[model samples]
Structure formats: structure tokens, C-alpha cells
Target: MAVAQPKIDLAESLLSRHAAPGPGARWAQEARAAAAARLRAMGAPVRRDEYWKYTDPARLTAAELAPAAPLEPEKEALYGDRAQLKLVFVDGVLDADASDALALDGLTVEPLARALATDIHWARDLYGVLEARGQDPVPRPLAALNTAVAGQGVAIRVSARVATPVTIVNRQRAADSDVVLHHLILLEDGAEMTLLEAGPAGARYNTCLEVDLGRGAQFHHVRTQGRDNERHAITHSFARLAAEASFKAFTLTVNGVLTRNESVIEFTGDDAKAHVAGAAAGDGRFHHDDTVFVTHDGVNCESRQVFKKVLRNGALGVFQGKILVRPGAQQTDGYQISQALLLDEDSQFLAKPELEIYADDVACSHGSTVGAIDEDAMFYLTSRGVSKPDAQDMLVLAFLDEAIQEIEDDALADGMRERLAGWLARRR
Candidate 1:
């Protein structure tokens, strides 16, 4: 199909700023070229698009980034006390001085730039493979653009069950910085690894992560989007699970002017499990969106999606999730829930939860709800001599705990709980 002139112009304008990677392997060159073509064909998202109707894409796709002053650092960074290998990026560039050594036992870690430069490497087969597969049934032009141009991120290959986690830290130093990052992760059979991501990447940030899990492999991920009131970001996560493999991811978002996160999961092997959950809190002038697509192609597979949001003072939240069970995917169990608590009359939540099952034996369900805080619960607490603000904060925490409980790691879950409590306390 021929692309519209305006779409071609927009794609070209973004591509003009980023040249194809220099002196790379043949496969890498081809992947970038193919991604560029895909982006031009699909075009940048607009409000008229079916998937983008709830949120505007103008700020994200604009020619220039809107300036966002960095926020003051918290007394302690998220997961700072945990023992892990750290990779730090300042204003979208890797900061060696602030990062730990890349060397780790039972794992091969290298910068994405170097990985793409190598003629022969395992990443060659996985870098853009999953992201390309995720494009089908839905068009993700931004992810395609990132695959074509992003040069700063990590490439990790896990060979065994690593005791420690790998953490990626992003920090913004410039008010007008625009960051594009792409990460590739591959887990071998019987391997296990955990990944942690935190911080506000840039004033305008675009990132994509592609993960592939072999048979019996397990991958756990937890992330916290930093508090930067004026920041704008769009992120994509794509994962493929093999037989008996497990994939779980949880995210906590507190503040941002405009934020959208998309996750695409494909199950290719039987007896696999995948869960994706998120909790978000927003105040005035805030907009948060979570979009997820999970496909089950293997028999006896399981998938879950849980998302919760708290909005107040005209903040808006959006959730769009779908579960697709193929013809041969019998005994597939899928569940999805998206709910929001509106503190005032002005706040709003929009949800679209869908389930499509071609297999007659599959069990799939989805639900979405929006409402205010429970007045009965509030009255009970207030009658017990608890302060109104304190009672409200407690109820708010309870409302968000369901999503937070999806995290497998107790310590990480505790950290997230504390962060949510602090955010609520500050408002009180």
C-alpha cells in the first residue's frame, strides 16, 4: 500500500536526524533498513488511529522536544540497597564512571552499540526479531523507528540462574534532551534472570525492549518510572516465551505529563505462563496509558493482565488490553482486569478490555471499572478516630495493593509499597 505524503514526510524528518548505524554487520544493516521502511509505511500515530484515539500523539512525535526541568533526587533511589549489577545512562548516553563493571558471572553483557558492530554474535538473531513479530495485527510505528535509530542500550544473554539482578538506571541532565534506547535480552534453556529499570530517561524519551525466553527459562522484571512532572515518554516491551517458560513484569508509575507503555507477548511453547501488571497514580495535568496484547499459540498456556490507576484533580488514565487464543491453543487460561479510583468529579478513566478465543476449550475473561473511593469504608475509618487524610491514604494503598501483589519478589514489592505510600502522604 502507498503511504500518505504527510506520513512519509514525518518519517523522513525523524530519520534525517539519525543516520543508519555506521560500519555494522550485514544482518544489522538489513534489520535497520527494514525497520525504517516499516515505519514509513505505517506512519506516526495520530488521534484518528483506532489505538491512539484515547491519547494524543502530537507531543511525542513533534519535531522538537518540550523542555522539562529535572526533578530533585529522592533521598534514596529505588532498589538502591539491593545487591545487583548496574548500568547507568545519563541523558541517553552510557556513563561508565557511574556504572559497575559489565563483567558478571554466568552472563554476557555488552553495550548494544558493540553488539550491533560485531559480525558474529548471538544477539544477531534476536535483536529485531521479536519486535518485528510484534508488529503484526497492530501497527507500532514508534517501536519500528527505535529499532532503526536507537544506539544506546544494553544487550544481555543469560546462560544460567543468576542469583543477582541486573539494573538499568536512567538519569536526565539536560532539560531538552531527547533519548532513544533499545535493549535486547535472550535467555537460554533452564536459565533465570531478573531485570530492574528506574529513573526518568529524558524530556522526550522513546525506548523498546525485546526479550526471548527458551524452554524452561524464567524472566522477572520490575520497573519504576521516575517522577518528572513535565516529561513525555513512549515505551514498548516485546517478549516471546518457549515451552514451560515463565515471564512476569510489574511497573509503578507516579508522575509524568504524558506517558504510554505498550507490551506485546507471544507464547510459542506449551505450558508457558506470562503476567503483566502495573500501578499508576496521577494528579492534575497528568495522563497515563497502558496498552497490552497477549497472544496464545500453544496449548495449556496461561496469561494475566492486572492494572490499577488513581487519578485526581482532572488527571486522566487509559487502559487498552486484549487476549487472543488461537485455534490450537486449547486449555488456555487468560484473565484481565483494569480498574481506577477517581478522587474527585473531574478525574476520569477510560478502559477497553477484550478477549478473542478461537479455541472452544479456552477460558478467558476481562473486566474494567471506574469509580470513586468507597464512602462506607471512609466513614468506618473516620468513626474509629482516624484522621480523614490518614484514612483516605490507607484506603488508596489498599486499592493499589492488588496490582502490586503481582510482583514475585517480596523486597521489590515492599519497595514499591513504600514509594506509593510516600506519594500519597505528600499529597495529604
Candidate 2:
């Protein structure tokens, strides 16, 4: 069926026009041009779009960027690990002088701009390939816009085991900053690495990360969006896994006015395993949403998704997730669950979980739930001399711990626990 004429007109009116790629490698420029064309054909975000019907899309499509005050540098880092290599971005501009050298055994990390300057590079083939492949089932126009005019990011190619994990740190120092970045991650056969990201790029930002996993590769990603009260953000992650590849990713979002994160994953080869999970907390006019799609096209692949949210004082949370099993994809194992704890009657949690299977022998299941904090547990803790607020905090931690345990690394899980505990402490 053809899209109505009014839909095209609305998309054109709401879509922001980004600047063209300048003097980059021929391949990058050509790719950007193609992406821009696709964005135009797709149109802008409208209420008619089923994927965005619950959330308002006007702010995302607005032409002007929002103003976000720079947050004071924290004396104690959120992650509290100084040994890891830190790639810093200030106001959306990559800071090369202050960052750790882009050198690691079996990995090549280059600035997107620099990669575009070279005559030939593997990034040329992956810059926007996986993102385009994820357009089906739903069209992500904001992601397409990021691809068309992403000015700063990194391209990482990993071919062997890396001894150290790399963290991407984004810092916003200026108000009304418009930040656009796209990162390409390519893992060769038998490669392994851990990728971490944190911070708010700008008041309004569009960020995209595309991951391509070769046979037998292993990749892990853990990210913290930010604690900025005035910030609004929309981000997307697209990943493709090959045979025997393993991918695990988790995100923590706290204290943003509005945040919508979309994740798309596809298993193209048999025997691959993937896990995606997130934990979010919001209060006082906060709104958070996570939309995810996992596709299984190969036999014997496995996938799991776990999400938890805490809301209070009229705050809102949303989760829309789906797992798809294609024809001939036998022995697929998929599981998904999303839950929320509401501290007050005014708060709300919206969830939609789905499973689509063509093969009769596969096992796929999903569940979603929203409920108030466990009063019995809260009373049990309060009876032990804990204050009401402190008891509530403990219960909230216990509720979210299930999702945090999804991280296999002990240190990483410890870091997540500390951050969540700190946030809860402040609120109490």
C-alpha cells in the first residue's frame, strides 16, 4: 500500500534539513547523500506513525536545538575507573588532545572525519550499512538524519582480543548545541572487546551506533545516558550478528526530561546468542521510553531482553519490545520481560510485548507488568528500624537488581549498583 499524500507533506514539513557532507572521502559523501534521500522519501515523525503514536514526535523533528547548561564536572567519576581508555567529546566535538591514544592491540580506532579523509578504509563499507538494513518493520527517520549529517564520531575495527576496555565520554558545555554523531563498530572473526559510553552530548542530540559482528566474535556494550534535568535525547543502535557471535548490551538512564532509545538487532548466522537489557528511573516530569526489535533468521540462535523502571510523582515510563523468528529458523530460544515500580498513583507505565514465529518448534515468550512498590516488603524493612524513605529505596534496589545482574562482569555490575544506590540516596 502506498503512503497517503498528506503523510508525505507532513513529513517534509517537520523533517529538519541537515548540512551536506563536506570534502570527505568519496565513499562517505556518497553514502550520506543516499541516506538523505532515504530520509526524504520516508518523511518526518507524525502522530499517524504507529511506532511513535504513544510519544510526541514534534520535539524530535523541530529545526532548532534545545539549550542545555553544562554540568559541573563530578569529582568522583560515575564509573570510578581511571585505568580504562577514555575517548572524550566536548560539546559534540571529539577531543583528541585530552583523550587516550587511539591505539590498542588488534584494534584500529580512528575518528570518523579522519577515516573519511583516507583514500581507502573498511569503514567505507560499514558507515551506514547496518542502519539501512534496520529500516524495515519500522522507519527511524531521526536515525537516518543522523547518518546524513553526522559530523563527529569514531570508527572501530577489531580483529583480535583487546586487553583494555574503551569508554566514550560525551560532555556538553554549551547551550543550544546541536550534536550529531554516528559510530561504526566492526568485529572480525574471533575478536573480543568491551565498549562503554556515558554522558549527555547536548540538550538535543541524535546519536547512532552500528555494530557488525563476524563469525565467533564477542562484543559487550554498557552505557549510561545522563542525569541532566533539562536534556532531551533520541538515540538508536543497530546490530547484526554472524555465526557463533555473542553480543550483550545494557543501558542505564536516570534524570532526563525526555529520552527515547531504539535498539534493532538481527541474527544472520546460526548458533549466535544475544542479550539486551536496561534499567531506568525517573521522577518529577520525567519521561523515558525503550523500543526494541530482535530478529532471528538463523537456526539455534538465542536472545533475551530484560528491562526495569522506577517512576514517581507523575513521571512516566514506556517499553515496546518484539522478538521475531523467521521461517526455517528452528530451535530459536527467546525471552523478554519488562517491569515497573510506581511509587505514587499519578505515575504511569506503558508496555507492549510481542512474539512472531514462523517455525513451529521454537520457544518464544514475553511478559510485561506494572505495579506499585511491594508494601509488605517495604513494611518488613521499616520494622527493622529503617525509615520509610530508606525502606522504599531498598525495595526499589532489590526490584532493579534482577536486570542489573544480566551483566556478566562483576566489576561492571558493582559500578551499576553504586550508581543506582547513589541516585536513590540523593532522592531519599
Question: Taking the tens digit of each residue's C-alpha lDDT, what string does model 1 give over 32-97?
Answer: 888988888888777777899998988988887799997566622569677999999888888989
Write one digit per residue (lDDT tens) for candidate 2, span 118-236: 77999887888888888887888878778888868999999998757889988888877777888889999989888988988877888999999999999999999767777788889
- Could you say which candidate leads in TM-score? 1
Global Cα lDDT for candidate 1: 0.91
Q: Which prediction has the highest lDDT against the true structure?
A: 1
TM-score of 1: 0.98
TM-score versus the correct structure, for each prediction: 0.98, 0.96
lDDT of each: 0.91, 0.85
Clashing pairs in 2: 11-44
Off by over 4 Å in 1: 73-76
What 10-residue stretch in candidate 1 is worst by lDDT? 71-80
